[model samples]
Target: MTQMTRALMTAIGATLDLGCDAIPSPGPGEVLIRVAVCGVCHSDVHIVDGDWGAPPMMPLIPGHEVVGEVIGLGAGVTAPAIGTTVGVAWNGGACGHCRACLEGEETICAQSEGTGYSRPGGYADHIVARAAFVVVLPRDIDAARFAPVLCAGVTTYRGLKRAALKPGAHVAIIGCGGLGQMAVQYCRAMGFRPIAVDLDPGKLELATRLGAVATVQADETDVPQKLRDIAGEAGLRAAVVVAPAPSAFTQAIAAISPGGAVIFIALPAKTRDYLPISISDMANHEKRLIGSNVGTRVDLLEAVELALTAGILADIETLPLQNANEALDRLRQGRVPGRLVLTMA
Candidate 1:
């Protein structure tokens, strides 16, 4: 393999510039991967626009949904052998000795490194990743299809898992965008009835094909009522708000049944981050509000397995690696109806 690699790099408030870098050998407990494909997430656009603030490093290669083949291994790494296909998500690595890590909750570990943020990521032909954090992937499926599973798939899966809803429970997936589409499939695969809510009728129609039992055209003021009507007497068991709009949160918080939970999975811009809630209502209804970061290594594995076994897949459109900037532009402008993946091959 060549010792140099091509990548799309950008600093905060700058555009992505195609550049080259010497592919560094993996350090201990790390692996060098030849990237097969990388999913362009909305977060990547946010990073480039400085919406999430300056990244820990400048000229960042922003991508968390990465799928690739292991080409080299550092010392003390043996399980994911050379040539094995693997996937890397946003939670790059965590300090094993932290209290959260000991409880198998590495996603919340204080010392966790975020892929594409705290560390160099997969927006390149080659990437170096912590071996312990890469999830081994099946070779049979098209690798490009699995890229978004590393982020959009696992993020929604983990968020819904945290709700602890029973089988046949009714869960409302607010926003029928990329992440919301994936969440709809997962809800069905996990044995729950999903109610898809979106302002776009086209997205709602696609969500219906993906397994949402019900679809609601989101009217800002009527969303909660529509969900309540669809959920019937049992009520909306839980609501996973994947839209980064405050109005979405307000609707979700009001739609869920008493004692149900609201799982927040989207990160909005700093300017619109605050949400005013009724404290008394929450206390009286016993509604739970929880924040879910990306999932741990274990959760990623389960999410992949469920996706493969249950025929859950992201609705995606592929673009060449060099068109990354175009992909980000589409996402930023809401022109993409589903996830966009950039293929290196």
Candidate 2:
């Protein structure tokens, strides 16, 4: 291995530049990984555009859905063998002494380090990660295809779990983009009939191929009524809103049946849009509105296992590391059908 590595970095907001750099060695309790592939996520766009606070550090390498092989292990790290394939996700490491960590809710650790945001992420040939936060990928799964599962897959999986859908439940997934596509597949695997909602017919068709029982065009007249009709007597047992649009959240609430739950999984730039539900309305209907972030380590491991067993793979367009900016633009404009993955190999 070379003593130095070249990495594509965002030196300033909205600009990606390449430079040669010395590879960082693993610190105590850390593991050095040779990055194979990294998926471009919406959060990466937020970082590049300075949407989520300021850039954590200058010359940031923005990528969280990372899949790689362990090349070196730091002192006191013992579990992951060198050369074993593993995945590094957004939650880099958490303070295990925090109450959240002690309760097994480490995803909300008060002092958690976010991958790519708080630390150097996987947009380079080699990246260092804490061994405790890395997930070992299954041998049968391809590394590239498994990358997005670290973020998008786990986010949707945890959102659905929080919704608490039972078998044969009616579920609606808004926005047939990257996250929505995965939600459709997961809903099917979990024994729910998935209704995919989107403004684009092309994405709806893709969702159907991914096992959606029905698709509703968001721009259609009376779209909420249409969804309610399709859901029939059972109505929507739960609706997972993967789209960041505020209107989608309002419509999702309207589409649910009595005693149903609405889970918002995406974070929008604008936070002012409100879903107005009277206190009496919520109490009488037993409706719930909640937000879910990414999943925990156990959730991520289960998602990876499900991906390996069910052949659940993200529909991705592979791009070179240099085209990361272009990919981000496409994603921001909603021009990309699914997740875009950057290859550093």
Candidate 3:
């Protein structure tokens, strides 16, 4: 067995610690990947900082947006032959027989396992992932550029799909950070006009460069009015809130068209998770607040296809794997405008 270097979270609210360990062989229905790059997600910061519950295990390796090459396959696995490039996402694995799985909605599987959470993740030099869960990626693209697509890309794509909007409709991408920027590009690729909302002018500018039709500053008064004005008579068909702020949710629910949906993907800290919504307005207006988890395997496939054909890619900054702690710090500080990817090479 080859020794692999990994970053480990010893406890909640602790900076990750670097360590060396032997790479384990894949078991049945698994594949061993030589990890090339892994995106540093804000959720990693949330997990490390205990914004969510305790990690399923201590000394957790926090990464899910992983891209790598398959170097070995477990027994009974042969399709994704050795040397194939693959990407692992937030969805690590799920029970095959659950009702959600049968309904082709494995993202909602009650017994779903999360990468970098319930199992060993991609913050290491190597990873062993469930064979059925890894998406085979194009060998042409730089692995670093594809890392965030495994999470942020699929996430926002699925969110938009849930909106059920028509082409030329307006969609608000709240936050305008890494995920929000991707949301903007996806909206354009999916044929909907994207309206970017954020407090940071820099991010809003970047969103425009990435194809946002309009930009709104979140801190301005009458933000909903501004959104309505920009969206015109059609109004915003949906708002994808990728920001972890409860205020963003409040604003999104208020800004979208009366019958429009507000898709929630961000997970704030447990203490700040509660939101007060008017049940009467929701009922009368038929507004919907929908929760989109990471995404299904099919959603990932579509996202990858859109990225390849429509030229949608993340704005990424790369760092050496040893600098994992620094990457997490930047994400935690909200200092990164786009995704930060940690490279093992």
Could you report the Cα RMSD, in angstroms, for every candidate shown?
Answer: 1.2, 1.6, 1.0
Q: Write down the worst ten-residue block by lDDT for model 3.
A: 138-147
What does candidate 1's lDDT look like per residue over 1-345, in tens digits? 565445545566667877778887999999999998999999888888888778887767889999989999999999699999999899999999989999999988989998988888888889899999999988776777778888999999999898999999999999989999999999999999999999899999999999999999887568889899999999999999999999889889999999999999988888899999999889999999988887998889989999999988788999988888889889888999999998885
Better TM-score candidate (1, 2): 1
- TM-scores of all candidate predictions against the true structure: 0.97, 0.95, 0.98
lDDT of 1 at 253: 95
Local accuracy of candidate 3 as per-residue lDDT tens digits, 1-345:
579999999999887889898997999999999999999988889889987779888878889999989999999998699999899999999998989999989999998999999988999999999999999888877788778888999999999998888999999899999899889989999999999999999999999999998998889998888998999999888999999899999988888888999999988878898999989879998998888998999999999889889988899999999999999888878899899999996
Candidate 2's TM-score: 0.95
Clashes in model 2: which pairs? none
Cα lDDT for residue 248, model 1?
89
Q: What's model 1's lDDT at 52? A: 74
Residue-level lDDT for 110 in candidate 3:
92
Cα deviation of 290, candidate 2, in Å: 2.3
